[model samples]
Target: MNILFIEDDMIESMKFQRTLSKIASRHTIIEAKNGEQAIDALKNSESLPDIILLDLNMPRMSGIEFLQILKADEQYKYIPTIILTTSENRADLLECYRIGIAGYVIKPLKYEDYEQKLTAVLAYWQTNELVKA
Candidate 1:
């Protein structure tokens, strides 16, 4: 599966890549540092990603802002976006669901925990049938 990973922190981005490398090699990851970059990727790519793993906090545009634009557009609304953020705020959680996210995963503190969560998330998405244009 092709994944669009949207995150601004370089260390966190590297950690996610490392986790993916350890858990699965069949999947492909496309990195975007912020919502603006993510939007550009969506607009310019020939093929859209199978899923989007987004971080709530980012520069240029917040994840909610990005979701608003994405969900509003007929061309992009079908893509399943999963929030992979550290925020545990109820308001944020409710907002993401309200905006129509496929999943919401709060990043755990430990690397092992993070890896486990990512592994399950990836496995589920990989095996599950998804919407295709």
Candidate 2:
């Protein structure tokens, strides 16, 4: 599977990469520093990602803004987007659901907990059939 991981924090991004490498070695991950960069990656990529792991807080554009733009577009709307954020805000959760996110996962403070959550998420998605286009 291919995943587009959008995050602004370098340390968090590195941590995620390390954890993901341990869990889903077969999956390919593409990194984007912000929502704008994520959009550019989508536009320029030869193939769209199977899923997107998005962070809510980013420098240029927030995750909600990115989702709004993505879900509005016909070509990208069907791709599964999951919120992998540190925020547990009710409003953020509600808005992400309203915008059509596949799942909302809070980034756990502990490395082990974070890895477990990511493992579960990946396992679930790996079993589901995704739109090839």
Candidate 3:
């Protein structure tokens, strides 16, 4: 599975990477620090990502803004984007769903719990049939 992981925090990114390596090393990840960077990555990619894992908060452009842009664009609108965020706010969840996010995952405090959630997310997406760009 090809994943585009848009996260600004280095530590959080590292933790997710570690968990992913343990769960599925065969999957490839494209890292983007912010919404702007993510847009650039998508524009330049030889092939689009199978799924997008986005952080809700970041510098420059927020995930909601990014989602608006992504969904508006014809070429990128079909990609399944999951919100992988620390924010547990109900408003955020509702807004993400309104903006047509595939899923919203709150980052658990416990490392073990985080790993479990991530593992399940990855497993489901990896096995699901994804339409090519």
Candidate 4:
């Protein structure tokens, strides 16, 4: 699966990328250091990703801002977007839902838990695709 990962924290992004590398055979993980970069990447790419894992806090443009722009545009709004952030605030979760996020996952401190969450997200996407087919 192709994935768009928008996380400002470099270390966290690398960890997530490595974990995903183990499971996906034909995966392409697009990296965006910030929301602005994410938007630029999306615009330039010929194909959109199957899933986008967004972070809440970022420089220049926050995930919330990006989601607003992403969802407002008819061409990009249908793509599945999930919030995967360190923030576990109820307000953040509610806001994500309000913006039509596909899923919300809190960043786990444990590697095992992180893998489980990633697996679940991947499975959900796969199931959704099968249903559509």
Candidate 5:
């Protein structure tokens, strides 16, 4: 699976990368520090990502803003995006769902728990069929 992981935190991003390596070694993860960078990555890539693992909070374009842009674009709207965020706020969750996120995952504090959740998420998406552009 080709995954575009949008996150700003270096430590958290590194941790997620490690966990992803363990759970889905064959999958390729393309990292983007913010929403703008993500858009640039998408534009430069020959093929679109199979899914996007987005972080709700970031420096420049917040995940919500990014979602609005992505969902509005007919060419990219079909790509499934899942939120991998630390925010547990109800408003964030509701808003992400409203914007058409495939799933909203709260990052677990414990490393083991985080790994487990990430593993399950990757496994589910791996088997699921994605919409073709």
Candidate 6:
């Protein structure tokens, strides 16, 4: 799987990356610091990511803003996006769902828990694909 992660916090991003690596060693993970960089990464990529993990509070462009832009574009509209943020507020969660995000995951500080979340997300994708088939 090709995963695009848009997170502004460098340390947090690296930690998630490490957890993901352990969970799915063969998966290709790409990092983008903010929404603007995420858009650029999408634009420059030869292939679209299977899933995008976005953080709500980011510099340049916020995750909600990115979700709007991506959902508006036909080429990217179908790509699954999951909100991965430290925010657990109801408003943020509702807003992300309103913008058509596939899932909303709260950022876990523990590496083991993060891995579990990643595994669950991957499983959800697989289950969805099976249903579609």
Off by over 4 Å in 1: 131-133
lDDT of 4 by residue, 18-115 (tens): 78777755567899988899999999999888889899999999999999999998978988999989898899889889998888999899988998
Per-candidate count of clashing residue pairs (backbone under 3 Å) = 0, 0, 0, 0, 0, 0
After superposing candidate 4 on the true structure, give the runs of residues whose Cα lies further than 4 Å from its correct spot: 130-133
Q: Using lDDT as the measure, which candidate wins?
A: 3
Question: Can you tell me which runs of candidate 5 are displaced by over 4 Å?
Answer: 131-133
Model 5, range 34-90, lDDT digits (tens) per residue?
Answer: 999999999999989999999999989999999999999998998999999999999
Clashes counted in candidate 3 amount to: 0
* Candidate with the larger lDDT of 1 and 2: 2
CA displacement after TM-score superposition, residue 118 of candidate 5 (Å): 0.5
Name every residue pair that clashes in candidate 3.
none
- Residue-level lDDT of model 6, residues 1-133, one tens digit each, is 7888889998887787677667634667789998889899999999888888889999889899999999999999888998888898999899889889989999787877887887888778755773233
Model 3: runs farther than 4 Å from truth?
A: 131-133
Off by over 4 Å in 2: 131-133
lDDT preference between candidates 4 and 5, better one = 5
Please say which candidate is ahead in TM-score: 1 or 4: 1
Q: Over all chains combined, what TM-score does candidate 2 have?
A: 0.95
Against the correct fold, how does model 6 do in TM-score?
Answer: 0.90
Q: List the residue pairs that clash in candidate 6.
A: none
Location of the lowest summed lDDT over 10 successive residues in candidate 5: 124-133
- lDDT of every model, 2 decimals: 0.91, 0.92, 0.92, 0.86, 0.91, 0.85
Q: What is the RMSD, in Å, between candidate 5 and the native fold over all Cα?
A: 1.5
What does candidate 1 score on TM?
0.96
